[model samples]
Target: MLFYLTTLNLARFLKEDPPFIGEDEIDVQTQQAIDAWKHAEFLCRNYLLNGLSDTLYGVYSVKKTAKELWNSLDHKYKAEDAGAKKFLVGQFLNFKMVDSKNVISQVQELQLIIHGIHAEGMVLSESFQVGAIIEKLPPAWKDFKNYLKHKRKEMSVEDLILRLRVEEDNQGNEKRTLNPNAAKANLMEHDRGSKGKNPKHKQGPKLGPKGGIAKKPKFQGKCFNCGKMGHKSSE
Candidate 1:
């Protein structure tokens, strides 16, 4: 809404205007005054309809003139706007990475929020932003945080963010190098666990060398079946 007004050079009309008196009641007014008033009315009606809520539309709908609606909204909402800016400042101050996001991502998010804080009227210096971001680093990042703090030169917000990205990447490579064996062990353990529930199958009885029963030995001149000495007996 502000941008719209700014582009058209009509922002000042909303913030400042001669005490609006009825056209008929005014003793003397210039042609410029009349034109400004007409444009403000036309733009304000459109702004309220398109930009604001139906509730606000209803609130301003009853006003007989656009100037009255503009003034009324400014008086009522501008005072309430203070709380929103305060909340933004609080968020900027209490920003913490926790463990939910990567270090570089958290820092980038913090940069966006800091920019928003500046837009909301709390301008912070580049050095201050850089220092605040370092301070808010999670406990696991103590070494990097201290390294950033102990730097002799003041750094811009972008510089600090770039350095943080490089540091995070270096740390990731180091972890991969030192723990490759541990990672392999974990994969092996998981594979073993996947088959842990089933029992092993037992082997069946061994097969003979030929696909037939073994031949029995016979005694000299003795019946093999009867085991008696003499002629072989037929059964």
Candidate 2:
């Protein structure tokens, strides 16, 4: 809006009031200057009014001069913008990352909150923003967050985001690699448990030629020295 007003050289009209000269004392030169100023003021006022939304236009259109309209708008929006800045600050401070959501997506949300702060004319340094993001990482990322905090080199927001993406991808790959091994272990444990609980799956002795269970043979030779029958000498 300031640039638009500056382009037309009518920005001064917002700060300066229209020239006042007595009708009885006005000369041709003074009259001409007054008319020119009036025209410029009119253009300035119209520009300001046209820039407003329908709601504000109705409320401020009755302002007679550019200075009046500009002052009124400044008074109204200044407080509103201050309140908006406070709300954005609160959001930034309260934001937290959770394990269930994507880390980069949550970082983007934090970036947007920072953007809103900038739009409100508040400046947040890039290093500060990077630190804030690290501080807000999920509990699952505590080790990585500590590593980031301990780095001696300064990091820009872009660099921080890149590092975060790499870390997130690595973590995801590690989980993918471990999942199959974990499943295999669980399956092995379940098989062992089932075998222990049910004894019907155990194998019995082999069958003989006639399909009867095999048995040990009894001794039939007599012991010569002892003159005993149905018993072996070695027994």
Candidate 3:
């Protein structure tokens, strides 16, 4: 389950509207971390489902080792790793979920991981360090360990209520905009007018003498408004 969730999140990150970073440009260390997480998740899941008790411990150990490897990566390496760093950040949530026995604990841990990832992404000038990231977490999160110990199990309820609330809230805040097709058409029309291609559009008409088109003056004329000899003005 954790493996699937990580895979899905990684896919979404890669497929973002403008893309966070390029996949092909990712560095070796980042790619190694991504592969390690994927392999660890697979081994952990297989060991658990197959009821291989001894192997399960080994799998968990490997998972921890892989996570440590990821956490130790330097900022220069991470930058070169591109999308791999983002992928590894997401894998932290997967790591928390893999061993958690309670839903609340899982959610809280996942939330912390998300917050850390967000902070790391936002702080562009600094190096990403696991210790530094943990240090930056809010006091509320630090106190959550004690809070989780006393928390009761929630009732088994359908998630439809939450879904409906989210939908309604989204609808309320949504902005209406011109359709892309209409916007493209409007832009094209604007460009045509700006380029003087729209025949009926005119800012000034150079009227011809009588029925013929007026010839452009080769030299400056006296201004009609001020009666200046070197300049011409139109009322």
Candidate 4:
């Protein structure tokens, strides 16, 4: 708002007193100057009031001069903005990334805190924001953090976020690849345990080496009825 006023050349009315006309002795140029000053003052004051909310408009509309309204607003909101700035700074300093949460989501949260700080009139460089994000990464990302820190090229916040997203995706793919192998190993171990716990039942009669049932040997000696060397009477 102040910047806009400065651009319009009306900001002087906020700092300068209104022009005075002497009784019965004013030059045409002096009268013109006074009239111009009054017009500018009116514009400046109306602009300020129009920018306010309905509640604030009603509250501050009683101020007759642009300078008074400007000072009152500055006095009120400046202190509030200062307190908000400190809170935002604290939030930024205390932000930490955790392994259980998505890194991109956490980065976004940090970005919001940065935005709040900027809105409160505190400016942070892109490189500083990038460094802060790296420092706040979870313990699992220590090696990656070191790698980023050792790089010679400086990165903007956007570039840093892109790099982090790629790294996170790679890590996710690796974990996905390892999970199936771990599950397979666990399944095999479980199967072996089940087999050990319940041994197989005893098998049926043994078969011949060729996997066929063996026939009984013929009677070599004479049978009781025939008494012959190799024949039985019944046969």
Q: Which candidate number would show the highest TM-score if scored against the true structure?
A: 2
- Tens-place lDDT per residue, model 4, 1-235, is 8899999998888887777668687889888888888899999999999999999999999999999999999999989888888888889888888999999999999999999888877899988888899999999999999999999898999999999999999999999887878878899889989888545668668798799887766777877885777664475
Residue lDDT tens for model 3, 72-159: 3333357766765577566663453232243334445544555666666644222233323333333434553334334454322123
Candidate 3: C-alpha lDDT: 0.47
Order by lDDT, highest first: 2, 4, 1, 3
lDDT of 2: 0.91
Candidate 4: clashing residue pairs, number: 0
lDDT of each: 0.76, 0.91, 0.47, 0.89
Which lDDT tens digits does candidate 2 get at residues 94-130? 9999999999999999999999999888999988998
Candidate 3: pairs in clash: 27-81, 208-213, 208-214
Model 1: residues with Cα > 4 Å off, grouped in runs: 1-53, 186-235
Order the candidate numbers by TM-score, best to worst: 2, 1, 4, 3
The Cα RMSD in angstroms, rounded to one decimal, for candidate 1 relative to the true structure is 7.0
Q: What is the lDDT of residue 202 in candidate 1?
A: 73
Against the hidden reference, what TM-scores do the models get? 0.63, 0.69, 0.18, 0.59
Candidate 3 minimal-lDDT segment of 10 residues? 10-19
Q: Which structure among the candidates has the greatest lDDT?
A: 2
Clashes per candidate (backbone, < 3 Å): 0, 0, 3, 0
The CA lDDT at 204 in model 3 is 75
Residue 65 lDDT in candidate 2: 90
